[model samples]
Target: MTPVPGDNPTPRPAADAPGAPAPGTAQPAAAGGPLRTGRPKPWHVLWLLLLLGWTVSAADRSVTGPVVTWMIDNGVGFMAHADHPHALGGLIGGLFFAGYMLTQFPGGYLGDRYGHRTMVVVSLLWAGLATILTGFLGGLIAFIVVRVATGLGEGAFYSNDRTLITDNTPPKDRSFGMGVCISGLAIGITIATIFTPNFIDFGRSVLSDIEAWRMAFWVLGAATLVVSLAVTWFFRTHLKAATVGKAALHLGAYAVVSLALIMAVYLIGDSTGLSDLWIAVLEVALAVGLVLFVLVRKGEEVGPVLKDRDLFIIYLCNIAILWNLWFFSFWSVSIVAGAAHSSFAASALTAGFNAGAGIIGFPAGGWLSDYGLRRGWGRKEMMLTFTGVQAVLTVAFAWYLSAADHPSLWVMGLLLFFASLFFNALQPVGHALTAELARPDLRGSAFGMQNLIGETGAVLAPAVGGALRDSTGGWTAAVWLDAGLVVVGFVLLAQVRGRRAVSPV
Candidate 1:
């Protein structure tokens, strides 16, 4: 195989080849001369575009967190209404996921079939338009519709970006590249935290407080639009040609597995009352189906589906970490705010968690993963070590939170910061492992499956945490229960096998 300019070096079948590259094997370079030593590759340009797209998508999604309270204060219909704050809040928040989950597979398929750049541009433009419209909407139904639309548009960005990076980047550099892209998520959220308040305040002074929310949305939409245009204009060059024949087989397998899981969940829901245990079991089953689908459909040359010892372990560990992680995202603030004796204290705690996770945790995680990879550590070692550390810290934090004597805000904030650190670090490591385990042709679907599985935590965390809190009249038991899940995840991860040292490029 020969490396061609603007051609993918990863092994796959030729455009006219009889069979696809065997699973797990890198697609072979095109039949041409070796890459010229002096010329710049197109990957650098694509990288910049990816970074821009990721930052914008992340910022668009995260901006809601900081601004939700303000929106409520400013007469945002559903959030401000007294009828059902909890239910309405949950509905508004979950709408994003609802839109997001619906588009995952379609996005992956389109990126594989059409071109990542096209999807990236389309998704960004569509979401940006919807976000701007969200500010202008007058009624609750309108807001929900716009938010859902934004979610649907934004859903494709992450998967498409991952596909772009995987297709263009060299295998040895894949993890680090992924880390760079993932870091954009943190960067966007951090920017929102620091700047959104000021933006809101400015809009209020210039117009009205209610109008400020509108202004924020409009401004965010405009900024995203500009970035998207720039990326599309500069990075619209042709993709490196690479065979993607295996995508069909992988998609077929995923569809079969996904349908089975959905049917099983429906049957279980019908057979049993929506008991807490049944719901939890259903969530776990869905997650397992997703993981198995991705693992099983991986190309044969890459490796056996379940036989790769380390891959399976990494999957379990990731599921555990993500379950706790999602719980923190969805309910931690609500719980802490409810528990704190004072509104001020509760608000502070909520802010601390967001800041810790968004500002500090994400970068720290990426840095640690990159460091471990550079130092010749295999992904399994890095993931397991971090998983254990995260579990211990989480358990200690839960215990502290459970105590009747409340700790000082400063102490609580510190603990929350460390927890976020652990949670954020898990992402890059998990992604690196997934990339390592999957065949190149299946990268997009692989990530889709990972996210789909990880999102099951989203479904479970709220339902389970809500039930526990409702039954116990406190969050103590809920937090402790999450800690136990972490432990279980760690035990499963301990079984994964991989090279002790990083494999050479």
Candidate 2:
């Protein structure tokens, strides 16, 4: 076969050099096992529902990052401090990820053991409550608590969603399915960044001050709840009717534990006259305890996936990638604000431009991945090409932005469009590669583990970016720093050769 010049480099993974078909097509589930063959099932339904859920997930989680700026500008929430705006902003941004970070493994375990339907239902409900409360709880303490809760709720959701998509899709459409499902993030971010300010202003026209922001949360939160129920109904009506009973048991257990933690925190805070520090500690303890409990139950089950060195490399690469992605996602509004000296609307519009690129890029990436596979190309090759090249361009973007003095909104938008186009293309391939490598039963756990490690970037990016800007006096240093991380991530990704090397399945 002639070499495909663009995606396939000569030094390709030796495994795929032979008979491997690109994933999402038919092949052996294991050596000499029954062929895992099915035409793409009615995948549209699952994609739409998951996309709806993910969009809400993205909007709910992303709302705070941009709004943190508004808080700083208005002297609300953590932004009450005039002295450390960057640090405060970073802290606020990081807190959500901190909450998100803790739940990766445990949530994955539950989703794998219990069910994806259960996980999605629980996550959406958790996100809705937290998002709604985040608006109502205006203080710094309340802000952190609720935002962290929102993140925790949102965590593990993607892993489970990925596993489910894999379950539904055949090998051929896998990348496209993932692209379609995950594009929700791009769309949700677009909605939050581009229209949310307008939504807030609309709320203010009816009710002024904090109510505007709060109303934004309220509306999104309510929508999240509605979507959760819709997903529950859809998944229940279709896939996992038997697990419904078991899911109720899981929810009950969660409710009981959550109530106990709430009571413990209240008692400790009230009786001891301890600061909110103790309460925070108790909350953390509860989270850790829950994770430990889940690990104990299925802790041993996660070992095989955990032991895979290549998988670990993939996780680290994901962390590196996310570090930059989240750094940009969480701080782009502010970065634009600073560079263009633009209003929130202008900043959001710039973000919208980047996200808009993602909306197209995500699907295109999947399609391209599939297209390469049909030509007998490899997923790893595509991943290496797309992610590696994008990583370099990201650094260049940072360098160019850092050097600019008062860049125009269009200039910022134009640069971001290309940078984001590459960045978004990486998603489908990375996610598809992950699904292809792991054992079927363990896909959820594998995804959870990778994301668990990966979210470290999410946890740090905001704070790191903020700290860098706070210290260096500009976003250039911060962007450069993240750019370096992405380069390192690409190095890690380079080490992650596919285990099967070539799976036609």
- Tell me the whole-model lDDT of each prediction, alpha carbons only: 0.59, 0.71
For all predicted structures, in order, the TM-scores are 0.73, 0.83
Q: How large is the C-alpha RMSD of every model relative to the true structure?
A: 6.8, 8.6
lDDT of 2 by residue, 285-387 (tens): 5555654565567667876666677777888788787787788888888888887777888888887877778888888898888777777777777877877
Q: Where does model 1 exceed 4 Å of error?
A: 1-45, 71-76, 239-326, 330-376, 404-406, 459-478, 498-502
* Root-mean-square deviation of candidate 2: 8.6
What TM-score does prediction 1 earn? Answer: 0.73
Q: Which is the leading candidate under TM-score?
A: 2
Question: Candidate 2 regions off by >4 Å?
Answer: 1-41, 238-299, 499-505
